[model samples]
Target: MWKPVPLPYKSDSLPLPAIPTAAEIRACTNVLWDGAHRIVALNEDVVVKYDGGLDATEGQNLIYLERYAPKVPAPRLYAMFEEDGKTYLILQRIPGVPLDSIWKSLTVSEKNGITAKLIPVFDAMREAACPWPDFYGGLDGGRVHHWLFYSQKKKDFKFLGPYYGEDAFVAGMLQNFRVSTERCERPDFKARFYEKYLPQVLRGHRPTLTHSDFHQKNILVIENPCPDNQGERSFEVVLIDWEDAGWYPDFWEFFMASDRNVFSFCDEDWFWHMQQFLEVWPAELGVMRLFEKDMRGH
Candidate 1:
């Protein structure tokens, strides 16, 4: 069902990463002509991937998103495949500008619309039980039911000392996971943020197709709305980047977005954004609320 649509091609000229040139992209891989992924400069579209991961499900995301097009500002996947120990995923190079560049210029209605659209798309993904949840990575799966603890591949959790500390919590969570993760975790943070807010995180939730890393960077904004034939503008949303895509706790996405990199990425605007979005989501808060509590000794 999921397949790549053939694109009309002209002379091969691809837009590459501003810093890392295509040569660098090619040089990084083992097999240039037959590598896992290499740079193919085909008219402003430069791809970075590796098909030779020995993972049969490699490049599965290209097929997943292609079949289910979310009505938002995401990338257009044009092609995907693996050959000679390398994988390739070709996508339509989105042309317009970065959302962050024009975020302030964007009307609040536009921002609200984007926030609203995510729910439906998330629902569609959950209903279908489609894996490859985000631009991160995918998991071999079928229809999922409840929250799946990462007991199987339990990686060490890092702590950022009341900031983005997944490691410390990772250690602690592995310890008294049986104990309630409520008040014992709070320190210097405010009340509603941790005590009351976080406890709700894992109370009522089941994991669906969580993007695991749906930050704004992973979410691209292409064209702004233009006056339609009837003077109305309908927004089109396209999701891109499925390397980090996978099945995991929704808090992972919320945590990464809240302020990743030891809180170097904090933004009050996004703080309010989460507050408002949480009112709508109502579920994701429980998981993230706990993380917020664990991050602060203040």
Candidate 2:
């Protein structure tokens, strides 16, 4: 005798957290972070981040890293879902203080040891397989998330990309630059110079996965967690906040890490430490700074 079994119909809906859990989240008083998104500590082991509008790619990026680049220390994503115009992501709570908190007190040798460990971690990330070999974008093959593709003229504009090649990516960047220069009260002569030289300046870079925001706050460190034979404490680092992680030009990691906006404010020698781990593209960085100036009006 043959009997037919029926299973529930499947749809593309994401998993939803328990109703009580969601309710508690909305009313949770233990907020870890308050910014564009709200991060609430659910318990000792987990935290949930929710926002009215968040880039879904961030969760995907975490999954991608865990799957493809396991050596890169990052948070474990427990659950992610969308409900009622808001997105919620439950994640493992990594135990460590932010690097910036104790950076000033670290001895030069200790700093060097910490950075030495990080160099290989970044190397592993760069070495991870690209989801789309020919395209530069988010892990899901969606639009690139970097600011270069952001539309300056449009309010809350959706960035453009998943470019098929380096040339196309450069074209997208120049298009945004043009929009930014258009209808300005004063003539932006630098815009004209960038229009002419940008293609040449931006040429010959292969796409690499970049954690575009690599600052002290985003990096967590556990100091003296383990002691070796000499009774010296070993340093450990875990990187967080993958919101801006994506495929970008090879030089992007260096450029973003070297930006001075935070140099005077937090971790004064952050740039110097960044230089130790990243390959310095002096000429490209200089040109990128000029472009950053044009884009930021500095």
Candidate 3:
């Protein structure tokens, strides 16, 4: 198993862009999205995402996709930097509104049309195999990272294992859970949890490049203009937010997609459409959720 490493650079050693303050970011009238740790602002054709000490892996992931998985429709990364404990990623803004904003308003036929477009994209991602079978986290050739065990306050930015097989990867996930909780100090409890639940939930599965958070919000949809009195107006689906994307077990995508945090509002039709591309294991998700509750002592 791979051990966690401290962030290599000190505060002063980071090569970064001019740090933009909260006031400066807030002043931007073209704010695209605002969340807890990151704020995305647009300036004409460029989109700048300012991460307030959350995660910098997305920028690197974008670069990796551009080079390795060019067929995947993602934003073009311009530049990235780490400054004053914040990470800034400058990217070419893809033309589209988030699917979530317009999903509820779309007719059933329109919704099916979007789902049809996504089918090929999901197939391509599943077909994009990693060069090394052992590599299980983050971009294939970039600095390793894991979004599942991430915490802003702890600053536990160390990369997890590039495990050789499914078993090792499952073990790595368990280790990460231990590290994230106070259970790290209790070996007996850890041992029991591992022996009891791990076997039930962790099954042998093939690995694939998964956009772990593949919910509506992370997807962008754009309607193309019909020219020369053409046929139907086509829509393009662009996947965004590669922060949580990585190579993982085939089931990882389904498990993460099932997360309520990913889908804020319940859309039965949208849910049904996603299942067509991938299968969800409710048994596995249930075990995982139980483990999470135990870790948090809830």
Better of 1 and 2 by TM-score: 2
Model 2 clashing residue pairs (backbone): none
TM-score of each: 0.50, 0.86, 0.76
Q: Write the per-residue lDDT of candidate 2 for residues 12-42, one digit (tens) a residue.
A: 2323344225677889899988897888887
User: What is candidate 1's TM-score against the reference?
Assistant: 0.50
CA deviation > 4 Å runs, candidate 1 = 1-41, 44-58, 68-77, 81-86, 116-119, 130-137, 142-203, 224-235, 250-252, 260-267, 274-298
Off by over 4 Å in 3: 1-29, 37-42, 140-159, 178-194, 227-234, 261-267, 296-298
Best by the TM-score measure:
2
The positional error of residue 48 in candidate 1, measured at the CA in angstroms, is 5.2
lDDT of each: 0.42, 0.75, 0.67
Q: In lDDT terms, which candidate is top?
A: 2
Ranking by lDDT: 2, 3, 1
Candidate 2 lDDT (Cα, 0 to 1): 0.75
Candidate 2 C-alpha error for residue 169, in Å: 1.0
CA displacement after TM-score superposition, residue 254 of candidate 2 (Å): 0.5
RMSD of 3: 6.3
Q: Which tens-of-lDDT digit does each residue in 184-275 have in candidate 3?
A: 45455664676567866678677788887788888999987762243444578999988878788777787777775424436356777777
